[model samples]
Target chain A: MSLIAVVDYGMGNLRSVDKALEHVARDGQEVRITSSADEILAADRVVFPGQGAARDCMRELESRKLIEPVMQAAKEKPFLGICMGLQVLLAHSEENDGVDCMGLYPGNVRFFGKVLNQDDPAEPLKIPHMGWNNVNQTIDHPLWQGITDGSRFYFVHSYYVDPEERSIIAGETTYGIGFTSAIACDNVFAVQFHPEKSATDGLKLLENFTHWDGK
Target chain B: MSLAKRIIPCLDVDNGRVVKGVQFVDIRDAGDPVEVARRYDEEGADEITFLDITASSDNRDTIVHVVEHVAEEVFIPLTVGGGIRKIEDVRTMLNAGADKVAINTAAVFNPEFVKEATDRVGSQCIVVAIDAKQVSAEGEPLRWEIFTHGGRKPTGLDAVEWARKMVDYGAGEILLTSMDRDGTKIGFDIPLTHAIAEAVSVPVIASGGVGNLEHLAEGIIDGMADAVLAASIFHFGEFTVHEAKQHMAKRGIEVRL
Candidate 1:
């Protein structure tokens, strides 16, 4: 089994995802979190986990000289983006420093400013959308393999993804309204929810990613 | 869409060292500020603040050096304060790669300094940090007196009123630290936080008195703070950033996972 590389850009949650990958992968399958571009390119699978703003995360990648390598890896290997990681895969984000992103997927990440009710609010559904919420898989994809519909996973973000192509959506979750919760196009797969914090169901999703053979 | 509650880690640094001391105790030693900062960045900290605790603002060069190192090493936004006196000081810090420069003593000493710095650096880059202590009486004004020089001197300025003036002068954000609970770990000063939050249209970051995850959650949910800042809990490794986010999520505070 080829080792999985978790890209480290000096910003984001690196350890929990590393541990979660270890927890799900079969014996002898290894996962390493690295900032080295060479290791990222050599790996069979790459997981880009981000915990900061979209622009800052991209700046870190550029500062480390890993943008080209990461973009190339997205094309060559099975790539996964978690949380803000998923958002940066798009053409651009509204929260960006007015810079273009990796453009691995054809979509734009935007804040849900229109949906926020002026009155009678559910006090908890404030910005950062941090918590465990259920997702309904909208498209058939291997990343969601063995995971059923309405399965709760961890989500923490203020922005939502709206793909230019509706066919790319793999899952949907409801906050103030149902938005695209996950995306898959070709070899690229991304989820707005955090599988690392999704508990048993999350581990199962990781297992599916480890064994997926689809192109 | 609800605004995302940010998870920020604060570092109290003195003489190029990270130290945690209450009003009257031997300061507990922490490790290198850079190394600790790197770890937090990797663990997914939304932002980091470096508060220089020493009294003097003379070592502007040293502050620049620290900012350069942190910028080269860490990816998230860095906010540094303590002894920042003038627009030139703000320029020096920002040129050294600090995303935001916080001001306390200078803002209190010369209220116009806040306006001048904000104009020079742009309102978004200028942050007015306030240290407050709650008053004793009821039916009287519930005043939050501003403290300066690392909580050593009282400015005779009401925190709420100061906050209003700072906003009027074009400050984009406020960093409010409570001296009464600076090292107590009891919890954040919620009433004070709400008052300030209510008083200002700009974002308010509640600093001091965060002992555990519950304190952080309460600061955001009940206190209405835009962000919660703490030093001991994060510095001593009481909880990982991920664990805190998990706890906050459980309590219904929006966090980045």
Candidate 2:
């Protein structure tokens, strides 16, 4: 039996993510939401998800003693990150002034800034870029098995990830400027959008994660 | 690709069942809110809004149950509103799998509650619902006035001014509904929606009075709404979400399709 642990450090809505995973979990598969190190370490896979400011997220992870287990899990197993989960995996984030994050991925999370484009200053880019937007698949990976390119994914964040290595970028999206929407390197895969809230394509991604062999 | 304009279907739920009414009266049962939401999800609805119209303490659990059921099957953003009076109510809805909570009466009564709720949950998940009615007093320029308690009580606050204030207080989005155009089905109140959308930097969802696919387009094109939210046009089989998206797309509007 495969057990997937959804890391819970008391941030973001874990219920919806857990329920979405459970809906896609197949035979001999189980999903658990836990902050317990043992549960996370023993699990076959891990899904790190979060919302709110990066500073507060990092603080909560440190307070709950989840920083080590989460870092270790990302290194050891097939890992998936969503939203804040993706941002925190980077070296640092511009949210809450600035916050240091786990250095698993070489990148810096940057704010979208006040203006989308300085040259064409028509619409002042809205912060927390909310709603559905298309994600352009950048590379062919097992995780992109059933989902098509240019499929719309739900995103709600003021900041976006700028990976140091562009090769690891699995998907790119535009919301004023083209930004890294998803990244992949070895067994670690993360997306800026909320697949759990992305409907069909999202469910398919979660289902693929369950069957992925961490290649 | 440009950011796709959203098409949201709103379900007014009571006792776990989806209901629809004109101006909060002449109510009729639509179906189970969860079932309706699931169908909309399958039909490619950009988002879903489940408003608990009952507003009774006893029905709180039922609303939560409905939200849970919808969230379980529908893997899309869900915004739950109606009777959200406090921080606890917002917490309850978000905990039940709702991505956002819309506050109307509570925000009008206690404006500080908007700031406090946004501070606690982040503005991205806090939506301020403004029910506005066009008021033109003799000798004064026409302006939209904010209304509360399902548009029954009017507040002196200007709709555009209140929208700007809500954004300043940390509201991420504004759900603007026009009382005069709500159930009339003629179209959205473009001027009122345009006023609020232009006033606030955040996205504004134009709700109420969607008669056809063209009306939905007008909400986005004419009214400049970030999203168009409808009820009867979708719930009563007048149009599917796909059709509306197609119409919008043909009109050169960016949509998911």
Candidate 3:
């Protein structure tokens, strides 16, 4: 049975995440919540849940000695990061007080900042794109296995990951402005929106992840 | 772009006890509000609304207790109501860590209270609550009337018209509760919820009448509400948040599963 390790860095909705994973894995896979680096390294798959800031998350991961294992797992095994977990998969974040991150993807997390051209009719919207938003599918990914293109997902973040490579972007969502909402490269996959919270399509995504054939 | 429907959990507190049921009927005692709040927060609830059902219109101490407990333990945005009337009440709740304040009877009695609260605390912090009950047909009554004071008093106000007026007065959100369907497990008042959602430009949270995950999906898909709030289904463990979100995800609702 494929063992799924839900990485617990002491800052996530572990119960809900655990429940969703258990619900989706129909093959009787073992799902364990662990703050252990070795357990994560030994697992066949790992899921990273994000709830707070990128800085704290990265620090906690570092403090737990999980950075290398996480990077190794992302490179050699399937890795799923949700929300702020998705944001730190990038190089840096403006929200992190200019902290450098895992650099899993070549992108920087940025806020919409202040609107400079409101009367100019072309001003981009500012941060904290709270509430539900529609995600425009940009590429084919197994995690989005059952979800249709342009399916809606619940989003509550003020910043987004602006990936340097457009080909890696899996989906996009519009706020006051449109940005990459989901991304993937090799064994690494992440979404700015919580698929765990995205409803039926979200569950189906989790189901697909459990059955993913990504190598 | 069409917005996603949010599934929220409502906590009704009476003397620090988190209680659940329809129209406060068949009350099942849940745990402490703080503990319940922590669980919901752990479940990834989009937002949480705590109704101080017992606090009087003049008492501020109870509200403060509820606020302090939640703010100290829970991390999600909180909406606290009950006994809130003045601008200072709004300030106190916000300062106590509530992201928003829900004003029901007060806003209806004085519509300008909504405007003043919005102006003072910013429109984002003001939520106008409408507890609506379907009046009897024929000689019964023509439409849904607003009920206040924990459903103890009926204001005889039209639910739809009042919602529109409140929105116009700058209320940022609407927490519309169906007194009749609450705790009934019959499901949400979809047509009524849809009407209110369509009538206002702001977000509408459909409360009361949620028995199962399907009920929640219906509230979002058919009711056209931005969110759905229920107490019993969540509090009693009939369905955990993950299970509910999974069911919704399978039904194609956008929730954080």
Candidate 4:
């Protein structure tokens, strides 16, 4: 039996994330939502999920002492980051001035403040970019299994990640401009959208993560 | 490809049972909230909204249980509305797995509550639901006023300006519903919706008076709304969420289908 730990550092609702993970977990696979460093490090697979400001997220992670365990999980275990979980993986973010993050990947989060859409050209896109958008897979990975290349996932955020390393970029999606939506590096797979709320394709992605061995 | 317009199915629940009424008159029971939510999820509904019509303090617990049951199976974003007064209410709904909470009358009574709720629980989960009634007609300056308590009491606040105020207070989204055309189902108040959608930088969800599929398209195309929400259209079996998405897709609107 393997235990999947979903890190809960006092951010937005992790209950739905935990419920979704448990819904797709197979026999002998258990999902637990914990902020404990030891429990996270002991888990076979780890999921880091969060939402809210980057600075606030960093503060909570530091106060809860989850920074080291999360970084360690990224390096060793099968780690999945969603929404702000993916943003905090970057080195710094421009949200609310500038906030330094976990530096799990060399990247920066940017705000899409009224950027003009390439498709529409005339009108400026909305700020929080909240809704369902298509994610075009850039590179092949186990997590992308069974999901179509241009499948749409539920996205709700004002900021998008700009990874410094080009090779780590796994998926790209267009909001105003083509922005990095998902990233993958060895054991770590992170996405800017909420797969827990993305309906069918989302459930499929979670099911794949549950069975994924991080190969 | 552009971002797909959302088709949301709003379930009006009264004391834990899913019910849809016309103009708050002749209310009829639809089905169990969980069962109906699950059907919509399977039918490719982008999101589901549970608006507690009862809004009674005692029934608040019932709404929480309803949200818990729906969130357990329906894996899409679930927005719970009605009677969300304070931060504790936000925490209660979020803990029960509701992705967002819609704040109405409280926002009109105490605007700072929106700011505080958004401050404590991020702007993404706080949705300010506005019930608007057009105070003017054609051949004149367009004006709409905010109405509270199911559009029975007028707050004398301008609809467009009120929307901007809520957004400035850190509301992530606006669920704008028109009381004038709510049960009429002729269509959305396009002018009112357009004005609010253009005024705010945040996404506006055009709601109420969605009679047919064409009305849904009008919300996104004409009204410039990011999403369209309706109750009777889906609750009464007039159209399924899948059919609505298909119709919207045929109209060249980007949809997940």
Q: Pull out the clashing pairs in model 2.
A: none
Residue-level lDDT of model 1, residues A68-162, one tens digit each, is 98888888888888886788888888874355778877778887655744434434234445445678888778878777777767565668998
- Point out the higher-scoring one by TM-score: 2 or 4: 4
* Residue B49 displacement (Å), model 2: 0.7
- Per-residue lDDT of model 4, residues A115-163, tens digit only: 5533363345787888899999999999999999999999999999999
Report the CA-based lDDT of candidate 3 relative to the real structure.
0.76
Q: What is the C-alpha RMSD of each candidate to the true structure, in Å?
A: 8.7, 2.9, 10.8, 2.8
Local lDDT at A39 for model 1? 94
lDDT of 2 by residue, B1-257 (tens): 76889999888888888777322222243476766777788778999998887757876789998988888888899999988888999999999999999998889989999999988888999999999999987677769999876688888998999999999999999999999899999999998988888788789999878898999999988888999999988777767899999999999999987
Q: What lDDT score is found at residue B236 in candidate 4?
A: 70
- Candidate 3 per-residue lDDT over residues A63-141, each given as its tens digit: 9988888887888888888887788888998875687888988888986544322423322222235565778888877
* DockQ (CA atoms), all models: 0.05, 0.81, 0.11, 0.87
Alpha-carbon deviation at A44 in model 3, angstroms: 40
CA lDDT of each prediction against the hidden true structure? 0.76, 0.89, 0.76, 0.90
Residue B124 lDDT, candidate 1, scale 0-100: 60
Best by TM-score: 4
Q: If ranked by lDDT, best first, what sequence of candidates would result? A: 4, 2, 1, 3
At residue B99, give the lDDT of candidate 4.
89
lDDT of 3 at B188: 95
Name the docking class for model 1. incorrect
- Model 2 bad stretches (over 4 Å): A115-121, B21-30, B137-140
